[model samples]
Target: MTFQPAGATTIAAKTPASETARRNQPLQSFDLLVGPLSFSQATRRGLAFYLLSDGIAVWLATTGLVAQAFVLLGLSRLLAVAFGRLAAGRRSARRGLVAARRPWLEALLYLFTLAVVAAANGTGSFAASLSGFPASQALRVSAATAIDAAVGYLTVQGDGFFRVVTRGLLSLLKGLEAILTLTPWPVLFAVIGFAAWKRGGPMLLAVVWAALGYLGLFGYWAEALQTSALVLASLCVCLVIGIPVGILLAKSPVSRAIASPVLDLMQTMPSFVYLLPAVAFFSIGKPPALIATVIFALPPLVRLTCLGIEQVPLHVREAMQAHGATPLQTLLKAELPLALPSIRTGINQTIMMCLSMVVVAALIGGGGLGYNVLFALQNVQYGEGILAGLGIVFCAVLFDRLAGSGRKGGA
Candidate 1:
């Protein structure tokens, strides 16, 4: 618990027990095996006895003699307890209880586990059969029917707010597609290349140019542009939603506890699973595709942004506070700057996720290189599918490089 000067770096010191162990080396190579487990003189014998017994119990269990296994386990546990008590002779009840409890607890656990295994094998049931008149399919159908009825009721009754939002998002996606597809290829290339150069230097700029050039040269110019626009739009949507939520999560432990499982669900569910809800709400098109992409790719940025902010070196924030910096000032100047590299990494992963969903996104009405790839798959055009896939790879590489540069620069 030694403290250093505020500006000085801290190094960890070895514990006294470890230093003692190092100084008092074991007498033989075999003794070295017991060194780690022997934290105290009395416990060493107890541990060794318990391990030997436990091994025998496990071996007996593996031989299909369940009753014998339990007997062995109990016998070994009793022996360990006896040894421990012998070593701790004439101790108080409290101390004796503390010393003896470990073996009893371990024995009970092993006994219970063996009993369950024996029961399972004897009954010929792994999970055991359930006897009931329950109607699972009926329950599922009823739930689905109720939900569909409710949604239909809402739709019929004119849900202005929901309808308005859906329409607006759809219009926005359409407008973005038109702009990207209508823009001259050379102009788009120059704009992207310039951005790459400004953020990533000359090497990245060349990569960006080559990737874009290949897309155009291979006759995937329009599809590439469309996919780029869709991916960019989805990324923007993810950031707009994810960052604020991430900041909230970082600042509030309660929010983090609530969000952890939701993020897990978002990340764990298949990408296509999102499309079902999107289609239900938006009714299938570019808008639904965009929404699904955002959902699929958003968790990483939110989780990483939260983690980055939380890991902003407590001392640095404290120093900022000591200098009369407000909370927002400390966060923006001290925390966010240090967290920039991690946030950039989050953004990189989000972009890649969005790109990966391109072909899946095309399954609905969302058109792009995904649509081209899907068309090839349907028509059995191997060359077309391969070219489209290569186009996607090129775009992914260019974006990945740009993200790498941003991350390094932040670092």
Candidate 2:
């Protein structure tokens, strides 16, 4: 009988596929096994279980266990060397084995490590005296002399060049001062309106206004303005120095590697520690405070710039190359635009760091809300301290939100 097309199709569907047959017959098993271990195996298992139970606790108890472990290992080597010399009846040879190959290098390394450990442990004074020795003092003095001489030259020259430069700087400051005074309230409102109009809407705007109101209500308007000025100055200085350093580091792997640890140290160094050197060099004043803030706040910008530039996609770089772009053109057009968001984040972080340092800087004669806060604390005026602290919080939140929103808007 010849099957019709429909009947043939039904037959094909009804047939069991090889795949389905295999799926149905998948069950397989080997013989069940029980184990007995040799002494070494049992010991290994026991040790593993012991470690699993107590490893973290042990580590926590011996906080610097890794460093301690290295020291112990080195001691063991020294002992072996001593034993070898004694066995050979050449006791003097032991000294040769244990002695540093390059005595000066070893001494320098030891001093560096000691300084680092001391700094980390918060013995900053000890580290400073040891690490920042006579050479540092001499360099600092020379720099100060050079700066003074340059200032003198500028003041005395009174040539068109000096006059133009001085006038330009004065004009800039006047413009900034005017902007600060006149624009803040309007800018505040405008920012609120923008935020409300955008993603966060009215709720965020209200919060922003409420914060500004609190600053005003506490009679901190002038202080807040001063704080803002300092923040702007510090941020500008950070960018001016940081961007070039970041570019250089990004361009050279050797520089990047060398700079990485230095940046880490600069960043991790305590805010208070910054005050000591600042005081020693620049003494107690607004200038010293500004310098310290710049030093502390600048690292993140530099790091982020390097990171952002480095992270630009290879294909994007290649595309720039394919277009016959010069290095300068590629950097200006391609790299900078792509890296901007990350750089913005860095700037935001820098502003935040500056805010944090305001109080510390005040300890070294910086004025602003920080000075008031310190004064309140010293006088034990709870209300004053609280009010000043709140003012700082308000300023920080305002700047942070504005910067963050600006970044988002850019993106």
Predicted candidate 1 versus true structure: per-residue lDDT over 259-346, tens digit per residue: 9999999999999888987777678788889989999999999999999999998899889989999999998888888988889889
Question: TM-scores of the models, in the given order?
Answer: 0.68, 0.58
lDDT per residue for candidate 2 within 306-356, as digits (tens), equals: 999999999999999999999999999999899998898898999999999
For each of the candidates, the C-alpha root-mean-square deviation to the true structure, in angstroms, is 9.6, 17.8
lDDT (0-100) at residue 91 of candidate 2?
28
Count backbone overlaps in model 2: 0
Clashing residue pairs, backbone N/CA/C < 3 A, model 1 = none
Task: Assess each prediction's global lDDT (C-alpha) against the native.
Answer: 0.75, 0.67
Model 2 misplaced stretches (Cα beyond 4 Å): 1-40, 44-178, 182-200, 405-411
Single out the weakest 10-residue window by summed lDDT for candidate 2: 26-35
